[model samples]
Target: MSQTTIQISQELQQELNRMKLFSRETYEEVIWNIIEDTKELSNEAKRDIAKARKEIAEGKAVTLSDLREKYKIQ
Candidate 1:
């Protein structure tokens, strides 16, 4: 595996050191959890946008005026 070096502040280094000693497993798990959550959100956003476009193409979507009225806007 290739190794990379990064620069960090003293405060961040101390916090990482404490996490390494106190919760090594959780630290790694948290990183993966964040990555997975980001991936899921990205996928959901793409799906929603695609569905909206399809609705527009099929003439199933409402106009901007309808949207404003639906939201109770003037």
Candidate 2:
């Protein structure tokens, strides 16, 4: 890989270092993990997920056989 140089404050460097799981992890990995973890879902998507989860938790989910029996589908 081609190498490039960038500069960050010592405080930022320390924060990145603290975020690392191991002493040998690269700053690139640390920054990428922070980036991936910071992803946000839309409000609508979040609401749908919450609703689906609640249905499953409340035993409101149905199997194909249950639906077939309920509707008496042949």
Candidate 3:
């Protein structure tokens, strides 16, 4: 792969260093992970979220407390 050098502030460099998963992790991997996390959700995921919200608003969803009581969980 082709490579290029770019300058970053010392603060930004330190932040990136802190984001590394391991001592050997590269800055590029950290950057790509940030990019992936900020990407938009897929259409299906969006629809599912909307459906779940509607169900919650309509009181069609069960509560965690109710499930715990039903299952005799403490």
Candidate 4:
């Protein structure tokens, strides 16, 4: 893969360093993780979320309290 160099502020560099998952993690990996987190959900995921919301509105979805009572959990 081709590589390019870009300049960033010292503060930004420190911030990116803090975002690393491990000491050996590269800045590219950290930036990619951030990009992935901000990406829009897939069409299927969006549809599933909308369906879940509708079910919740219609009271078709089970509540945590209900599950606890049904399973005899305190």
Leading candidate by TM-score: 4
Candidate 3 yields a Cα-based lDDT of 0.97
Clashes of each: 0, 0, 0, 0
Work out candidate 4's RMSD over C-alphas: 3.1
- State the TM-score for model 4: 0.62
Provide the overall lDDT of each model, using Cα atoms, as 2-decimal numbers.
Answer: 0.73, 0.94, 0.97, 0.98
Could you tell me the lDDT of residue 35 within candidate 4? 100
Sort by TM-score, top down from the best: 4, 3, 2, 1
RMSD of each: 9.7, 9.9, 3.3, 3.1
Can you write out model 3's per-residue Cα lDDT over 1-74, one digit (the tens) per residue?
99999999999999999999998999999999999989999999999999999999999999999999999998
Model 4 residue 10 lDDT score: 100
| Candidate 4 lDDT over residue span 1-56, tens digit each | 99999999999999999999999999999999999999999999999999999999
Model 1 clashing residue pairs (backbone): none
In candidate 1, position 2 carries an lDDT of 83
For model 2, how does the per-residue alpha-carbon lDDT over 20-66 read when each residue is reduced to its tens digit?
Answer: 99999999999999988888977998999999999999999998999
**Models ranked on lDDT:** 4, 3, 2, 1
